[model samples]
Target: MPRVSFVHPKGESQEVEAAEGSTAMRAALLGGISGITADCGGEASCATCHVYVAEPWIERVGAPGPDEDDMLDFAECERRPSSRLSCQIKITDELDGLVLTLPESQ
Candidate 1:
């Protein structure tokens, strides 16, 4: 399992272990990480699972695909260079200890 740390805007955080091949959104939802609403489940249709890949983890996580990028434009919070839809981030051995920051809103 890869452990992911979810940090909120105010600096609070929660860590959860995600099953390999699963998405960060699924893991966060299952772990009860509040900031992720996942309104469209893991289909990538909703920007509700928005998160920022902590600077150090950006390269490892990479940029979003075209489809995901389009949806990100609808995120409730302002988007940044590091913004990504959690549903688009797949958990893997290489992603262990990845850190994601949650925006103030979905």
Candidate 2:
């Protein structure tokens, strides 16, 4: 298992353990973390699950693919170099302490 920390715009954060191989969006939703809407249900068709990978976690999570990048352009919030769709990030031991900052509107 790996752990993910979702940081809200208000500075609040929730850390939850997730099963390996599962998507970060699923973990956040099941953990009851706010700010990740995931309206497209991990299909990479919507940007509601947009999040910014913390500086340190960026490399670990890797960059979003073409489709995800396309959807990110439609996010309700401004984008950052670290922006990514949580649905595209899978939980792995290397990302055990991954920290994602939720967009204000997301």
Candidate 3:
């Protein structure tokens, strides 16, 4: 399992063990981490799982697919270079200790 750290805009941080192959959104939601809504249940249809991958972990997480990219346009927060939907990020050994920052609004 990999550990995913979520840092909220208000400075709260939650660290959870993410099972390999599980989406970051699923891990966060199951662990009770605030800020990840995952309204579409990882279907990539909703942008409520928006998050910003920390600089060091971005490359490890890779880029989003077309569907995720399109859904991001409707995220509750402003999009940025590091913006990504948590549902699109799968847990892997390479992503151990990955850090994600929650947007101010979602």
Would you estimate the TM-scores of all the predictions?
0.98, 0.97, 0.96
In candidate 2, where is summed lDDT lowest over 10 consecutive residues? 33-42
User: Higher TM-score: candidate 1 or 3?
Assistant: 1
lDDT by residue for model 3 (4-72), tens? 999989888899999999989999998999878888898999898999999998888988888888988
Q: Which lDDT value does model 3 have at 7?
A: 95
**Candidate 1 vs. true structure, TM-score:** 0.98
lDDT of 2 at 17: 89
User: lDDT by residue for model 1 over 1-106, one digit each (tens)?
Assistant: 8999999899998999999999999999999999899999889998999999999999999999999999999888999999999999999999999999999898
Candidate 2 achieves a global lDDT of 0.91
Could you give the C-alpha RMSD of every candidate to the true structure, in order shown? 0.6, 0.7, 0.8
Question: Model 3: which ten-residue window has the lowest total lDDT?
Answer: 33-42
Q: Which stretches of candidate 1 lie over 4 Å from their true place?
A: none
lDDT of each: 0.94, 0.91, 0.90
lDDT of 2 by residue, 19-94 (tens): 9999999999999988887888899898888999999988889999999988888888999999999999989899
Q: Model 2: which residue pairs collide?
A: none
Model 1 score (lDDT): 0.94
